[model samples]
Target: MAWGANSRSSSRSSFRNSPFSDFGSYMVVKNRKLQEQFNAEASSSSNSCSNSGKPLFHGVSIFVDGFTVPSSQELRGYMLKFGGRFVNYFSRHRVTHIICSNLPDSKIKNLRSFSGGLPVVKPTWVLDSVAANKLLNWVPYQLDQLASETHNQPTLSAFFALKSCAVSVDAATRLTDQMKSEAEDPLLKGGTIKGDNLS
Candidate 1:
């Protein structure tokens, strides 16, 4: 009976020492901290905006993605100041816009597939809207439009087609020029050349 009790105690100790044993406690503590921080920020932001007159972005909420020009922190401050919500995580029902400077093709495709036509706009849209003291039309700030216009880039298929055409034209021109030169050469005009033997 003593040995059985000792074994049970040892087993309990080992289970406590396992890597995942503290995960639940750790997550609880982390979530508490995050909640506290959010509450503090919200109170401060509300205080600051209480006397600032009407909020420009009262109905807007944004989720930032990747690297942004004004940075996520600044955007968060802007949102809070302008009476908008800055979501730290992507929530399809809560997020009204996605702010990003750039996203890779695969990431963009994934976002588009699931985002249900959420407007992906540049950081400039927020800044310019803040400056103008109103929400501007988002059409001109669309990520796809801005990327193509700013980089002077064509669509993938069009780019490949243009490259193939250029290569073909260059090769054909070189072959045509070589044939014309060989035909005009006087020394080989009457000779038939075959496999390094001339007759």
Candidate 2:
């Protein structure tokens, strides 16, 4: 019974010393460090922005989608500095604007279907607003506008196809006109050229 107890104690000790056991503690420490770093950066940016008078994005909260030009981290810093809310995860109720460089037509349609007319603007809107020290109209920066414009414009292949068809029609018209003119010519008659002999 004593030997059995000792064996059990050794197994417990071995389990405690296992590499897998350290993973949980390591994750906790890492998370804590990341939280502290984030807090420090946020506070510093907010402090700097506070010195610049009123926050440009005071009441606005934005959610970023996919990849962006200035990167999510840089945008987060800008939001903190300008007194805007930057949500890590997207929530329609909490987010006032969606920032994205580009979204596919399907994704744009999906967003429009459920986004309830949420203003999806480019990152330049934020940057330009920061530069101007005032929020610019989001209409000019709307992603849907771009999508609509692209949809309305003819594609390269379609344009080329139309041009080719026009050219073919013009060539056919010219050939028909030449045939009529040749038949009407008094110098040539009975399927004979003016300069040719029928032998």
Clashes of each: 0, 0
Give the alpha-carbon lDDT of every model: 0.79, 0.79
Q: After superposition, how far is residue 105 of candidate 1 from its true place, in Å?
A: 0.8
lDDT for each residue of candidate 1 in 6-106, tens digit (9 for 90 to 100): 88999889878865457677666665675467557866875223234667777788999999989999998888777777877677887899999888878
The runs of at least 3 residues in candidate 1 whose Cα sits more than 4 Å from the true structure, single-residue gaps closed, are 1-36, 46-53, 145-199
TM-score of each: 0.54, 0.52
Error of 1 at 140 (Å): 0.9
RMSD of every candidate to native, in Å, equals: 9.3, 11.8
Model number with the top TM-score? 1
- Cα displacement (angstroms), candidate 2, residue 20, comes to 22
Candidate 2's residue-wise lDDT over 1-199, tens digit each? Answer: 6759988999889878866567677666665675566557766774334334667787788889889999988888888787777776566776899999988878877877777778889999999988887878998888855557657989999999999999999999999999899889967668656765668
Model 1 residue 63 lDDT?
93
- Cα lDDT for residue 196, model 1? 57
List runs of model 2 lying over 4 Å from the truth: 1-41, 47-52, 144-199
Which residue pairs in candidate 2 have backbone atoms (N, alpha carbon, C) closer than 3 angstroms, thus clashing?
none
